[model samples]
Target: MAGRGDHTTVPGQFPAQGLRAVLGGWSGAGTKPRNDDAISGRIPETAYEMQVKGAIACIADGISTGLNSDKAAQISVVQFARDYYSAPESWPVRDCAGRLLNSLNSWLHAQNRSGSPDAEGMVTTFTAAIARSTTLHIVHIGDTRCQRLRAGRLVPLTEDHSARFMGGSESLTRALGAEADIRVDYAQETMAEGDLYILTTDGVHDTLGEAGMRDRLAGLPQESREDLEAASRALCQAALEAGSSDNVSCMLLKILALPSETLPEAHRRLTAQVIPPAMKPGNRIDGWEVLEVMHSSTRSNVYLVRRAGEDGRFVLKAPSQNFAENLQYLEGFTLEQWVGRRITNSQVMKIRPHEDSRFLYYIADFVEGETLRDWMKAHPKPSIAEIIPVLASLISAVRVFHRLGMVHRDLKPENVIIAEDGTAKIIDFGSVQVSGFRDLERGDKEELPEGSLNYIAPEVLTGQGAQPLSDLFSVAAITWEMLAGRVPFDLEERTALPSRPADWAAGDFAALRPDLPPATGEVLSRALAFSPKDRPEVMSEFLGEMRKLQGRAGTRPVFVPLLQRGSRGFWRGWALAATAVAAALAVALVALLP
Candidate 1:
């Protein structure tokens, strides 16, 4: 522990997401002749940088094989700290850190290959901890350690990358620059205020055994910043006293504060934004001229709009005036734009938020093309060659939503635009099911399912939550319509499907599309399975089967025969029953007339 007179101030501060962190560390060579270990960290002073880049701390240990081993250690830790912050703010912590480490590893490997005199091969063990937005991201390699000290209880957070060989010599199994390509280990954990993290080189941990270290880490009160530093210094010194042979290094990080508002509370604030007035072609709002009213309905209005002095065209979408006060509608509208902006793809619409415009409106690219619905109208029998690639792009877009724990429950030709370049872009996120947002949106109950019945999965009629397979089913329906010009079974607009599974199976799509290759139509038919479990488990499987159908005319797919359609005459029985009911209704009407 530090003496009362030794009140060492921290080097810097990094604040973000309504939270504050106090970082401290101490290092030494211990009994070793010279130190070959390094510790470094960077905390951004600006909120934008802090929220995007967050705070990063790392430790590196050099192998004794090279004479200038310390240089490798120093460069690894210091460069990681610097380069991590300089990365683009739009990237997530995991992506930014992973990419930088990969680049750094390649550079270090190149240095080793150069074979220069007096130059130690640039290879070292690396471990980094990133604190960002109520979460902690861990990027690790080699045998260094990272742990969380929460509620005075030590929580081990990393697995050491070391193995014992046949000769009983322990060696690092993974380390940056150890080979031409490195596999970085990554992990994540949610964070809270009063949380503390401890980073240590193997020298410190190997000497201070588990029980000894656990006892020392327990009961670290938030007495003062010096106390935290004192704990770190004591841990390092204790390892030296225990006869550690290598250089010892340790870093301590404390979460002094965390954001008070829940995610739901922050989301509601977005809904409180001002609603825009009704728009017209000649009217200008927020400095953007409305060129044309593209589409409008009970839900929202979309307009072709542009800002003066801007070279590119844009589309503006706003909630319907009547639904301005509807909280669910507002949340859906906000979420549509939110999801649009987060996703990165040319096939997915890009939503640009207007910082100055308080009105509830968002601008996106004015893509030049027709909706897949309209395009299908023009090309009813689109060649398999044309539709396959376009549909593949659309499936890829849906996969992005799946990766983010969301489901596009309502997928149809109307919601997809076939761009002039033939790329497919999905739009209208009103029916996107965000699995992560359920807790935040629990208060806003949906009275009914929010999708067009023509494309909705049969299981949805049984009041089941929308699953990714449900979206795949909708995708199959749209593909079917493009080729066959109709759904498997005729449906009234937005009408409820038969509740029974038996009735659903009776709609044999094979009977109507006999011209299509049995294998091709067979694969698409799997997507229309009444039970999600019976469908392709993933979109990739669906796409793979579709790809296999290309250029193979003789391959007969596993055909599930139209069950009980011949002798039993299911449709004929249904028609007869319907006619009988109609006659009874007529007789009752005549009696009433008399």
Candidate 2:
């Protein structure tokens, strides 16, 4: 075997610190007149597609007994590379592979002829893999094998679809073109950096048992790593030297990196972005012209901007030029855009798609509307009938974020904008907390909660992390403020709301609104429970109780159930009744004894 040290091949680079990789493949006819094994691999160009679909590698081995087996092998390998890339980027890897292979199988099955062993058809063994995120997805048919060489051993990642034949020979019982509707065996395995994936034809694998293969892989040259082409050539050469008379083929892929954004890398990318140049009205930056300063704050400045040649009106939020070094604020600004791009709900604010701008800012649809806080001022002392739908919409919008593993920590009425058409759009995601994104913070100490203190949950003030329950607590607070003109608790600075339901007695909501129902107070009390465990764990549970208000009774009931009135009263009643029964039973027992 020639050493790869003598040759140099350029490696592939991808996003996320250039997810680098090396690939090598080799094929040849051992003793056969013509080779019938084919292989191909691909890496997408864009970061989004690469992260979503990942890279693909495929191998196919044609049946020796079938005519045009060489064509079968070549076509399967070639078409898969083309079709897999052409599939929808939004589809999951499994769905894309299945849909593409199903069409390929249909085409091959259409070419079938005789049902004999030595039949003329385009039947072939097929196996392929996709490496994405931190996983490898493998889909196989027939006998071409996919295996991983890790921890000094070769582990098979596929199973052959062959049955016992006469004299210990094996015949393929399942293949790509064997049936009209094919079943593609699929599985996924977690992957690590430096992991090696090897695809082989039966000729290469059958000649070398698992132990011999492990030895061969271990013997691979390590001095000049990333020599996949040389390793593959060497692997195929070994199988030929081992007395194999069939076509030999091998493909190798060495994982160097997985696509992911680390905290340091994210900081670098963000800091590299251009800070918005200070400009008054009529200044143009990257095809957008500033019209007027919409608003200015210590953190950022919002401007009403216009596209150079388009009629679209947009709101551009630029970080204040002075705060460029504030990584905490920059992180929030970046995350606001990230969340905006991913979530598409009627009640959630939508960011307008824009060309890559050099400034540290993003564009959003200019909603000419008033904040919900302003609306509350106009509709002071709003009735419960008028408040349920709006509150429901708010909770429903928050649920979308939760479904995507996000928490809207700052969900106060001030962040919610109410359009003239009565549509409520939740805006300002800079304070939104993401469970996954937090993992990338690299031990960066969490700053104080940036949420509005008046509507924040009690736990947030006590230095606890915000959760879904805490998020709902804010919504319930807004609900109370909307109906009774104030939240269940006082909103003074440095005053944290009680943490448990038992401690919520200080907030007698009905005292302010004499007409308020006890049921409404109970739900509000449960939602704003001091301990998150006592609060409704899911938004649906809180919404379910609110839904009961829309039943035959237009409002919540004031009647307290016997069981729920108070623990003390129920236990006391039971004790009194038990004493009377005991006295009567004692007199009866005395009469019986006499």
lDDT of each: 0.75, 0.75
Model 2, 58-120: lDDT tens digits are 888888877877777778888987887775443456766788889888877877754544435
Instruction: Give the poorly placed runs of model 2, Cα more than 4 Å off.
Output: 1-16, 24-41, 47-193, 199-209, 218-251, 257-268, 277-292, 341-347, 353-358, 395-409, 431-449, 453-474, 488-514, 524-544, 551-594
TM-score of each: 0.72, 0.62
State residue 99's C-alpha deviation in candidate 2, in Å.
13
Show the lowest summed lDDT stretch of 10 residues, model 1: 1-10
Clashing pairs in 1: none
Best by TM-score: 1
- Candidate 1: lDDT over CA atoms? 0.75
TM-score of candidate 2 against the unseen true structure: 0.62
